[model samples]
Target: MSVLADFERVDSDSGGAVLRFTGNLSLASLGDLPDRLDRVDGQVARIDLSQVARIDTVGAWVIHRFARDREAAVEGLQPASRHLFDQVVAAEHPIELPPKPESPFVHLLAEIGDAVFTAMHTLYGLLGFMGATVIAFWNVATHPRRFRFHATVHRFEVVGVSALGIIGLMSFLIGVVIAQQGAVQLRQFGAEVYTINLVGRITLRELGVLMTAIMVAGRSGSAFAAQIGTMKLTEEIDAMRTIGVSPMEALVVPRTIAVVTMLPLLGFYSALIGIIGGGLLCWVQLGIPPITFVQRIREVVPLDDLWVGLIKAPVFGAIIAIAGCFQGMQVEGDAEQVGRRTTTAVVQAIFLVIVLDAFFAVFFSQIGWI
Candidate 1:
């Protein structure tokens, strides 16, 4: 067992106080010594370690702290103890507190700036990706044998054929709602017969293509991102490069071409189904026969409206495919990034589609398509 550390204050020959320590000054023997030292009030000229039988790092730290706080000189330490004490003193450093937090208003402004910068960076990257896609398309155009026919056909089924049931159902419901609401408002002014015009024109010129684009953005766009992102995570994309296969030609081009070709057909189909639903609703509520309704639609809805919708469809499809594939190609690091990119693909596609639709609307109106 080690002797407990003890200390006594004495008058020194130099006419000043000295703290004389005794016993083994180790961690186990240091009980109450630190507290006793802290209670010491008088001026301390020196700390005497001559009678200490042994010492450890903990003991050195305690002694060094007391000596430092009192500005007293240490005396009679053995060589090893002196070396340990010197090391303890050398290792001591001031603790750094955390920096103060910024004000909420400043933080909000910083966040807004960061968001704007990120959006600009994303736009630049999307433009670069679109250029790459166009180059890939040119390559395929130059070498027709390089096209992946089976992959593109499969994508056609996935992006177009498989979506028919849900898209048709949604469009039918939208048409019924539009007819019903238009009838209610028109009936107020005895203009209920104009409901046919409302349903036909809106379905063909705006709602039909716009709604189909939104659905495709949510469905096919997200699928492209997830599929490509998974391939990237599994290093299949890298392996394709190793095998001299171009990912852009093999994967991206097929999907892009599939979407670009199928979207117009799907939009037209959606518009036709919506018109049928409106006709059914008109027959049920207003007692208008299907033949009369069809005749009225032919007279009221012009060829210009159908042309407008068709013109927008391919552009919306291209935007959806490009956004999705671009986000997928950007995926790196982990599986979580795949999910984030997939969501971003859908949102980005939808946002761009709406913005372009608005631009198309303005352009068409200015050109007297209305």
Candidate 2:
């Protein structure tokens, strides 16, 4: 085949000239085509190959390079030529992206995995902590100023009590929505009374505790990380150590105690709000009185459901605190590190909570507890 046999340029109203082709393809034309195409610099330029009898790799490469480098568009590409263009686009190359661990849907799954791993790690860490606390027990025994009980109490109040209004309001809205959903199903079966059973069991056993833990993960877990992270960045942990104080005993202990103790109470509050909110729904949507709603709850909620919620509390609390502490302690001495740790704390905390919930689901289901 003869190279440059069809190498010819022509001008038109398509706004620019096209270097048209008809016969053979070769590397020599590939080399010169770019410079020739450059001649149409100030005009819209295209290379048309509709009639090219035979095209080789070298010729294709020259045309492709010329078009790309000069931003000259290519025209009349057949399926084969189009596929060649796609090959270059699909080449694996590095690109920048945000550090979000995963996208929205994948993030949900990642959080579940994090919750499970973080729960396991926290349980391991706590075992070690408990051992050390026991060894130091006798030394602090009978000391009047021991425990920093006042500060621990204050943190519980802060993390658990202060969050009630928002949790309560959201729970109420949730209950209303659930009741509305139930009314639709019950209307068909004529079992409207069962809405009470559904909401009661669902809220007390699962939604109550699960939702509360998530809230705490986002709210208190973030605060814990940011606070401790800032302290770490400012050398406060080092300062405590320099003064011969224990970071575990003084810092981690107080926060851990606060979160663990308060979670169960928060869980109870969440359930209460959710149920009462449901009760209000019964009144508004179902036309049942609040008294009847309470009566139904008193009938169905076994002590076991409350216990299920209670049992999960300390576990979730431990997960959130440990995740926060881990990320916080991992922070280096930088302002940006504080924000990074705070985000990690919230995300890891939420993740561990969901995983723990899944474990409870499986364990309770097998035991006929759910």
Number of the top TM-score candidate: 1
lDDT string, candidate 2, 190-281, tens digits? 99998998888888888888888888888888888888888887888999989977665666667777888888888888888888888888
Off by over 4 Å in 2: 1-146
Task: Provide the clashing-pair count of each candidate structure.
Answer: 0, 2
Clash pairs, candidate 1, are none
Give me the runs in candidate 1 sitting further than 4 Å from their true place: 1-47, 50-62, 66-96
- Candidate 1 matches the true fold with a TM-score of 0.82
> What RMSD, rounded to one decimal, does every model reach?
5.1, 14.6
- The alpha-carbon deviation from the true structure for residue 344 of candidate 2, after best TM-score superposition, in angstroms, is 0.8
lDDT of each: 0.96, 0.77
lDDT of 1 by residue, 165-266 (tens): 999999999999999999999999999889999999999999999999999999999999999999999999999999999999999999999999999999
